[model samples]
Target: MNILRDVSKLVCKTDRRALASLLKYAETGLKPQYVCKGHMSLASQTDQNEDLDKLYRMVEVEVRGNDPAVLKSYSWFTTTAAMELGITVGECWTPRKANHERLTLLKSVHIYKKHRVQYEIRTYFRFMQFLRLTGSTANTFLEYIQRNLPEGVAMKVTKVEITAIPSHIKTHSEPQQLELPATVEERNL
Candidate 1:
């Protein structure tokens, strides 16, 4: 029973170390070749690097409106469109006043209510799919937004920006072997 308990404790410690190493890799983007007793083989590393090289594009649309309700409706419309197009829609940022100046009492209150909202639509694709996303595609997306805008609201698209995120390719090399110190019991033995 004592031997079994010691073995279980050792296993748990190893598991914890392995999980921590994986999490470190995720957070810092550092590729760890040795995990516990297992080795991240060269072929696996190459495959992972290849997958990371894939590109993703993000489309940011800026919309301005005077009514919060209209902006909410537009947000829903854009989310539905992104789903239909098989893309991901990021959360809309809180609407901010387009003009920051304090309004005088004589000025129209309507001018002070102007707000702007930004939406991000992201799509991940391979080389061929990326090629399919061209200027016409953006135009089509703009036309869709323009056509679906809620009525009775003075909403207008301020700007549309598209940017691509390309992964940094790293050269693959052999990982140095780390020497671990012996456990207390092993050292005593």
Candidate 2:
């Protein structure tokens, strides 16, 4: 099993104590997270680098397919933008049933308005990125009907599925958020 899958499964097992163990295991460090969205959006890196210190990918991906190079490049750029914006784009590859079997990501990008810190808005998640290491990977992008896209921002989703299926494009806007109620986590069982 991939280290992240194992880690996520382990973290999901117990309650209060498990979270502490997960923190030690993940070592996301105690440094304060960069405040955005009226809350801590992302934390500064544990190890300092003179340049490009705040954001480093915690996952490594491997892809095999026949597609336009420009499209692939565009996807990468968008994903990076999403990361900067604090979108909870799962660092997962295709065959999604397995990736999201227990977890469903309700990810979005929210701008702090006055602040230019484009923040990723994860509606909810079970784990952060698995781990950055050696592995063969696929795409596990999701298609959503963007319920509430604020403005001046565009949502770019993965254009294809791992099984070579042509997934439809989806965009979220204000109207959709009106439908779904807020997350009720305590009663998940």
Q: Which numbered prediction scores highest in lDDT against the true structure?
A: 1
Any runs in candidate 2 off by more than 4 Å, and if so which?
1-66, 92-189
lDDT of 2 by residue, 1-189 (tens): 243454454343435454454455456534433322333222433435434312223433333222334324544654565465445565643332222223333343563344443333322111123222121221222221123222232334323222322455454454443455457773473
Residue 62 Cα positional deviation in candidate 2, in Å, after optimal superposition: 18
What ranges in model 1 sit over 4 Å off?
Answer: 1-56, 95-100, 105-133, 151-189
- Estimate every model's Cα lDDT from 0 to 1: 0.50, 0.36
- Who wins the TM-score comparison? 1
Writing each residue's lDDT as its tens digit, candidate 1 over 38-130 gives 534323544564532222354556555555566666777776776687555654664333434333242454666355344433221111011
Q: Which residue pairs in model 1 clash with each other?
A: none
Cα lDDT, model 2, residue 115: 41
Clashes of each: 0, 18
